[model samples]
Target: MTEGDGNGFDTMSRRPPSRSIIEAVAEAEGVPAHELRPPTYESLHTVIDPDALDALFEPHADGTVRPAGRVTFPYCGYTVTVDADGSVSLE
Candidate 1:
């Protein structure tokens, strides 16, 4: 994904929202996603189900787009927001 608007967020992405969220959060933490592990940080699964998050914004079973919307939740002290347009923001 490209850089965001100078804030702690990311520009729109073509990747799955779940992947975007992990990458963005890791970027904010100044580490790679693989490094966002136990002892220092918490597991993403401790906060939310990654698979379910991906499904929420994925296209329908028939390949139709889901309605425009967003899902927000708390993870690792940041407010994670995933937009239907594939933008993810950490606040």
Candidate 2:
């Protein structure tokens, strides 16, 4: 539900993790999300499948939340970590 800049980065509440990642990185880079494109940065898809990433943390078919978990990967310059609770950290 929150996002941070500088040395610490955090969560996104309503948006999907994929979109949150873009926003978080854009904020960190001091650019608009649209500016996070070719010639400056690689597309997020080139690094990770956005749709799959979203699905990984979605609530289960039965409406139960998944167990606590996190996914980490390298994108842009920072390592992105997305938690089951929807918190995203960039480091």
Best by lDDT: 2
Q: What lDDT, from 0 to 1, does candidate 1 have?
A: 0.81
Error of 2 at 28 (Å): 0.2
Candidate 2: clashing pairs of residues? none
Writing each residue's lDDT as its tens digit, candidate 1 over 1-45 gives 333443557657878887888888888888989988787887788
Q: For residues 1-73, what per-residue lDDT tens digits would candidate 2 score against the true structure? A: 2333545587667578999999988988889998999988999999999999999999999988778989999
**Segments of candidate 1 deviating more than 4 angstroms:** 1-8
TM-score of each: 0.82, 0.87
Candidate 2 local accuracy as lDDT?
0.87
- Candidate 1, number of clashes: 0
What number of clashing residue pairs does each candidate have, in the order they appear?
0, 0
lDDT of each: 0.81, 0.87
